[model samples]
Target: MDDVIIPVAFFLILAGAVVAVAYFQSLRNRERDRQWADAMEQYRVVVERARTEQEATKLQLVEMSHQVKALEKLLLSVD
Candidate 1:
């Protein structure tokens, strides 16, 4: 009976330790997943901002071209 009790107590202690380690590992994984999601969201916002800036630059270029053409025509008329 004494021998049986010692082994049973050791087994219970080992099982508890394993359970604790698994719980902590689960928590770590959840945190990592959340960080990944946040990074992806940030990346999406940055990409959208870049696209908007590109469109604005395109509009500016078009306006500049029209102004240059008008200036050329006015100078020719002066001559």
Candidate 2:
């Protein structure tokens, strides 16, 4: 009886330790997931801003090309 009781107590203690470790590990995983989500959101925002800026720059370049063409025609007419 004594031998059986001692082994049972030891098993219970070991199970408790395992549960504690698992709980802490889960918490760490959740925090890591949260940080990853935050980083992804930040990346999305930066990409969107870059796309918008690129479109604006394209529009400016097109307008400049049209103006330059008009100036060239004017110069040719003067000659």
Candidate 3:
């Protein structure tokens, strides 16, 4: 009886340790996942802002070109 009881107790203890380790690992993985999601969201916002700025710059370039053309025509007329 003593031999059987000792092995059973040891097995229970080992199982409990395994369960504790697994639980902590799961918590760590969840935190890492949340951090990754936040980083991705920030990257998306930055990309969107950059695209908006590029479009605005393009519009400004178009307006400047029109102004240059008008000035060139006026100068030619004066000559």
Best by TM-score: 2
Extract clashing residue pairs from model 1: none
lDDT of 3 at 63: 100
lDDT of 3 at 2: 89
The residue pairs in collision within model 3 are none
TM-score of each: 0.76, 0.91, 0.86
How far in Å is the alpha carbon of 71 misplaced in model 3? Answer: 1.3
Per-residue lDDT of candidate 2, residues 3-73 (tens digit): 89999999999999999999999999999999999999999999999999999999999999999999999
Model 2 misplacement above 4 A: none
Deviation of model 1 at 69, angstroms? 1.9
Q: So what's the TM-score on candidate 3?
A: 0.86
Per residue, candidate 3 scores C-alpha lDDT tens digits across 1-79 of: 9889999999999999999999999999999999999999999999999999999999999999999999999999999
Worst 10 residues of 2 by lDDT: 1-10
Q: Where is model 1 more than 4 Å wrong at Cα?
A: none
Positional deviation of 26 in candidate 1, in angstroms? 1.4
lDDT by residue for model 1 (1-79), tens: 9989999999999999999999999999999999999999999999999999999999999999999999999999999
Q: Higher-TM-score candidate among 2 and 3? A: 2
